[model samples]
Target: MAARSRRMTLPSLAGRIDPIYKPATKPTSDPAHSAAFIFLHGLGDDAEGLENIADQFQKNDKVSYMHWVIPNAMEDRDAMTTAWYRPSPLTAFAPSRPELEEEEDEQGLVKSAAYVESLIDACVRKGIPPNRIVLGGFSQGCALSLFTDLTSKKYSGRLAGIVGLCGYLPLAGGSQLQHLRAIAELPPTHGDVPIFLARGKGDSLIPKRIWNITLKGLEAFDASSVEQHEYEGGHTINGPMLRDVCNWLEKVVPKLED
Candidate 1:
């Protein structure tokens, strides 16, 4: 056994951001067989709040090949709450303002993006191959994950999958899409990275129309690589959704001990 490792949180982006992560327990002692799942939390939530959810995978005999990572958002709000970046309205078409700007910071977005990129580099350094890593998040975290996937040049290699929960792509309007196209296109990493997007049918903040737009934009890249699911509830995760996520992992991740 390669000495049972402990959780570690590291700083990134010139110390502007931090991410909390737990190394996956290897089913065996093989270093090359390990995988990682990076989890990003929603707005107003911190790494500690989501760490418990990551711990859920610890019990699965099939999950030992994977590590769970929860990256803390850049901005910390009242008490222990955190956010990746300030979220604006989905677009002009979004319903209600929905308290998007309690503390808006543009520079924070740049810093946050840099922080996430650094975290990915850290994962590679930790001996987990890029192709075996899955990046995921809830709400605001999902938005950041999508943005990072599309923008980061480092994402070209070793990206296995991306999971977005109750989130939408930040770029709106054709001009922004054109800019994204000029920089890079969707399914950015590996040319065939699988993407899973899950949302609640009753989510008031992220309405069905917004999800529709996201799906449309993703389809522009590689429709086959994108998969979407809608649950019955609102603005939160449910049991079936978790099961679906686990199943998705089983399919994408290699070397899972049956």
Candidate 2:
């Protein structure tokens, strides 16, 4: 096993970012970093709040070779707290979803997606391939990650996988998103990108209706590669879920040398 190192603080761009970056504990390849997982923390949380994932994985040699990028969400002025994007409360599902058209924060969503891409760009600049990178998040972070995978022009269908926990798909029924999805023309690889989504059975924020809707939206997007997990809890993570996430990360971005 490799020795643990201090966490490295990476600057956010344009004064809206500060991410905790952890390099692989053990080098699995010549350059020492074989794969990367960029995770976004939920609303009201910072990168440090989600640093335990790195603490756990770095000690385990199986995935210790992975570089972890955990980022903080910028402040949502409306809510007066940190968030990946502005939170627009979801109204009940109706055909055409006029609420989505009128209330969803389109500008904030696009900007946050770009921030995620910038994180990906940083990893690519470090020499990792797009297919070796996985994007993931919790709550608001999860929502933004899924949206980014669907809408990012350079990486829409090119990431290794996506992990969304305790989250619902945002702007699922909106016309603008529908049009963007159409224009994006997700390559066949988009469907091939594995999506690991887990929800808490007792989660009040994401009721049964919302989960079903999220699933349907993914299906409409032609997401054939997805793994859905259900755990006993509320709008937070549990032990079993974390264990499953570690296992999933191993499978998604495994050792290239092994």
Per-prediction backbone clash count? 2, 1
lDDT of 2: 0.80
lDDT of 1 by residue, 46-84 (tens): 677777666776766556678776776654553245677
RMSD of each: 5.0, 4.1
Clashing pairs in 2: 12-17
TM-score of each: 0.81, 0.88
Local distance difference test, per candidate? 0.69, 0.80
What is the C-alpha lDDT profile of model 2 across 37-125, one tens digit per residue?
Answer: 89999889888888987787676665877888887777788879998778866534543745345567778889888888888887887
* TM-score top scorer: 2
Q: What TM-score does model 1 achieve against the real structure?
A: 0.81
